[model samples]
Target chain A: MKLFLYLDRESVVHRLHPVTKLVALPVLFGVAMRLERLETLALLALVVVVVAALGRALDAVAGMASLLLTLLIATTLMWWLFAPQGGLLRDGFQPAALARSAGLGLRLALMVASGIVFLATTRVEDFAHGLRTLGLPYRVAFALTLAFRLVPTFVASGRAVAEAQRARGLDLDHGGLVTRMRRYTPLVVPMFLTSIRRADRLAAALETRGFGSGEKRTDLVEHRFGGRDALAAVLLVGLVAASLWGGELASQPAVQAALGSARAWLEALYAKAASRP
Target chain B: MRQRTRPGVLPGSAESLGVPRAEIARRVAECLGLVGLAGFERREPATLSGGEKQRLAIASVLAMRPSLILLDEPTTDLDPVGKGEVHAILRRLAADGLAVAVIEHETEELLDLDRILHLDAGAVRRDGPPRRLLLEVAELAAAGVEPPVAARASRWLGLAEVVREERFADEVAARGVQVERTGVRPRLATRGEAPVIEVDHLVHRYPLRDQPAVDDVSLAIRPGEFVALLGANGSGKTTLAKHLNGLLPPTSGAVRVAGHDAKKAGTAQLARHVGYVFQDPDHQIFSATVWEEMAFGPRNLGVGEDQLESRILAALEVVGLTEERDRDPFVLTKGQRQRLAVASVLATAPEILVLDEPTTGLDYNDRERMLALLADLHRRGHTVLVITHAMEVVASHCERALVMAGGKLVFDGGIPELFANDEVLARARLRAPTAWRLGRMLGLETLTPEELGAALRGGGGGNGA
Candidate 1:
């Protein structure tokens, strides 16, 4: 209901430059990667909590908690237990090891929490405008925006197809996996086919609207970078720099070895994510 | 002064290829469905379907009378009925010694084709006989395409000779008939007046549009009354309906549900008084189970779990989906999904229900089922305001009608008045119902089939009654 329902209002977060939020994601990403310390990640999580509160996105946050937690746990386990030799398990499962596991979990949680913060705060058009500002080609940017926009659109289509099927008294539930897939195959085909058709329309529409002419396009809600925006940007960059510097400053050779290991694990995580469609 | 032409000269390529202008025109007409348009050759490339573009791609090649035909997703946008016709045409073309290369979504429609090219993400995943590719490959299921309904049903029911295509089409056709029949009227009487909802000078404006989506529209609904709001696209019908439940604040007007001013009311408050259903059922359906979906609105309003159970069951009963209470709404058929949406709203028990374009893409049977549900709501004394395009729906279910033309309420009266005025109907971009059209053709006075049927039988009861 929340996904499809309209919640109309205007707020400062809504009015911010989409590019500001977009750039904020990578900054947070860098911070999460650099800030291997548990305390620093906890502070980042606190900042996210404050932003979610301000944006009135607590409900959305709570709704995504399970998925976020699952991802956090999965990533932490893969990083700590499965990333070659000398992990937390190698040191044995004791209070100190548990505390280290908690640190890994907290860092992953902060990363996910920050992502939800942006998604809940940003509108579809705001993100598109941000991409445009970043000098992404309009064709690709518009396609990305349209793809996001089609989330609700295709959901609507899926509902229609389901309803049409139901009205015909097709029992979608009383079937085996293969049977169910077979039953829904016709449904999925039509929707997939419709999406391709919609893509064609979108391409033509974008072309007609002068999407990729290398001309500046005005927006309905123009996102001007304000003094607060500059301050926020500076603050984000500072945090990432501080995290890396702090991790390096901790002189314990053991800590340095762990940090090196974490970096390798993070690279592997990114490789896996990039491999998916 | 010209020499005689050679006797062996070929006719124009279009004619030589047997690609009659009439066939192309017919295919275009069928694809457009009820949407009117001129010939495709004159239209812009921007106005064609992905399927149409593919067809045009073939048509171009075929125009030269090439011995080969390459097809891809030919009936993508086409409905079930259209898919059969197009498939048949393609088969005929193949029989005529034209080498046809076809790529399609469902194998059912393309089963009889000479060959199949199985590609997954630009790679030739498989190249084989249709029987081997379809029967042996477990990967086809993972690849997200399925055999025709007949094959599926046969496999499921453990029955031989049940081909996938046969079963699938039979299911589709049977469903279509069922939906059409559901449109028939149930036993009901004209509603009593209680003024359940009222609007005075309602207006709304989109952020950028010059004209208000809704403008100075004043109307009222009595308790248990079924009223239909009729208008063309962008006519403000949806905007006006949204105000009934406080989804939108009137720019400069008043809206009251159950005598409470909706402008000052919160959506939660409005939810208790007036349940609003969006045009798209997906807008309201996200819960995993039917029961949970029915409980969603009420739960949002802070109803306790114990009370929610009864409310859920009662609402499910009202929508005639009690049997499917545990099923996933996403898995339900089109008509069932709509009922689930209605049930979700009903669980909140609002005094008034407002629906936007409730029958936009519904088949005849599903439309009937919806009409029956609306009739039931009216009988149960709930205020029902339906925004619709179908004149048949207006004639049958709606007692009162409001017609908007260009952001103005040009007509507000009984349903009879709506069908009687040809000029007003034209201005509203509405066609008269079939009965009304027939009556007009025969120079009769009434505007509905029931009225004409009554008149033909010499019954004197007022058709309005």
Candidate 2:
């Protein structure tokens, strides 16, 4: 994984304070999980896509689309096969079962999409800074930032170890699942050793740099919540409220009738496919 | 008044330290400018090149306004250009009244500093001016330090001690030493045989980057040839080396190793013919004992148990690690670990050896021992390709030199030809070996100090000074 997910772009979503973005992720996740109707879940997914587009993060979304698509397919299939609320449609087409699985799948996809948007818009340093501003200890915030920074370092080290092993004729590709995993197990030893050595050096470097020298640390960049950030927070709170109440509204008679019509249309399409020669 | 410079403090946070933000900004800018990274404020530290990262590290320290800055081998893994840049920065810092102390192994470059402290076994063996101590050849050799080439040449010619190249040349001219204009021609390996490794118009672009790391580069290495690959940081030396061993398949074009297509063959198959030794030995050594480390390659190749012992023993003997076979590899010295890394590859019995900066962090003796081992391998008919920044190693060891610049093969020829070509050197950001530079100034051609001394002594005339 990349160390930093921040895409350099000028957009309203990117301009929001990082704390607002952090708050929006959990709020969106909460709403996504609580909403039961397929239409509400689809609407949440659309909202996430729109936010990603506003942040100029479509490219990142496109890059992750294949992985996300795989997740969507896997989740949809698992839910269709194993969901307790729906029975397996072995005898004939079951529109209610299909709708239930699709709703769960769409809800999961929306949660992941919202997370991607938040990561893409917020810089790692900004996240740490926001955490510090929210009363996290400076040491804890710095450690969190350093962990993010070390992700790339560890990745590069892991690659080096793999390459080194490959050069030594350790065949990692042509093997059974168990055999391949066993081949990779040795790599962990060297990687861990290298990380330990690097940590030692980094500790020395940090100590020499007065990391814990008893001075109150200062931030180079200060973020303040401006009018736009306040607006974003209010919009986020309103969305959360809607998500909490939207489930009851969707169960109302008029909404149920609309969903029933949509379900009939989907069932007809499924039947047509089932009737094909 | 007393001043304290806290290490690891962010240069950007001068405001919370009761300093004005504008003053912090000015200080940061000045420090960055001093380190030659003026416009890289927003660049991630991880994204910077090794040299640039070291410079940035120094810049951060400089931001603290430290009176005395101590750096431990700041140029350990940097390319020659990077090393020179860091040295230049240190010189400037020292000139600006900041006491700069650096722990480095490449003392020849550090000879220009105010004083020299020669240490051996963690004890000071000599302390004096660089000119006096560096020229004391026997004393330095006893102390396990490699004296400057100029000093060695001066001693060989029975002249007074001279450490600097320009001073050595001036002394030679003043004494009216007749240089025979003879140059040392390296023994070029026979070229009639089919090339063992062939790269045809190779191009490798990383997934995220717009441009290729290894551009349209083509080269062929014949059997038993010793070649040096020279380039600055991010100039594609390592990328090109990776292609030879199938560690990295080309994005376009072809790479053939020992008649096998690198792109089609797995890395294991390529490992049988081209053994790649990485820069850091720690990345490869995981086994507890040296014997197990040596046996890893052959074991991976599925060598018979009967032959595995023999192969490990023979490889250990080659690297002179037989005495340390039972010891844990982690406990071995840095030099021993590097030798073990080579021995591990040697057990696979590959014909072509690709080493990426083997002498990077080794002390004088260890570096010499490693080069001697390579020389021994070359004598055993192994085709050796070394990626290195040490011009002296190229001058004394490799028969041919390939220079890369911006991912393209800019120059390929004999080492002397490479040294004499100023344009290629400038493009590649490489300096000629010290003796060769002195020879150029004196209207002669030479690659090593012994050759320069022989030329002054009017030895046999046909390019063997």
Best candidate according to DockQ:
2
TM-score of the second chain for every model: 0.60, 0.93
Calculate each model's fnat, 2 decimals.
0.00, 0.54
Instruction: State the local distance difference test value for candidate 1.
Output: 0.62
Query: Each prediction's interface RMSD?
Result: 20.1, 6.8
DockQ for each model: 0.01, 0.35
TM-score of chain A of each: 0.71, 0.85
- Candidate 1 chain B lDDT trough over 10 residues, lowest sum: B1-10
* Alpha-carbon DockQ of candidate 2: 0.35
Q: What is the lDDT of residue B242 in candidate 2?
A: 96
* Model 1 interface CAPRI class: incorrect
Model 1, A47-70: lDDT tens digits are 778777766776667777898788
lDDT of 1 at B239: 67
Q: List residue ranges in candidate 2 displaced over 4 A.
A: A1-3, A89-92, A176-179, A247-277, B1-22, B154-164, B183-190, B459-465
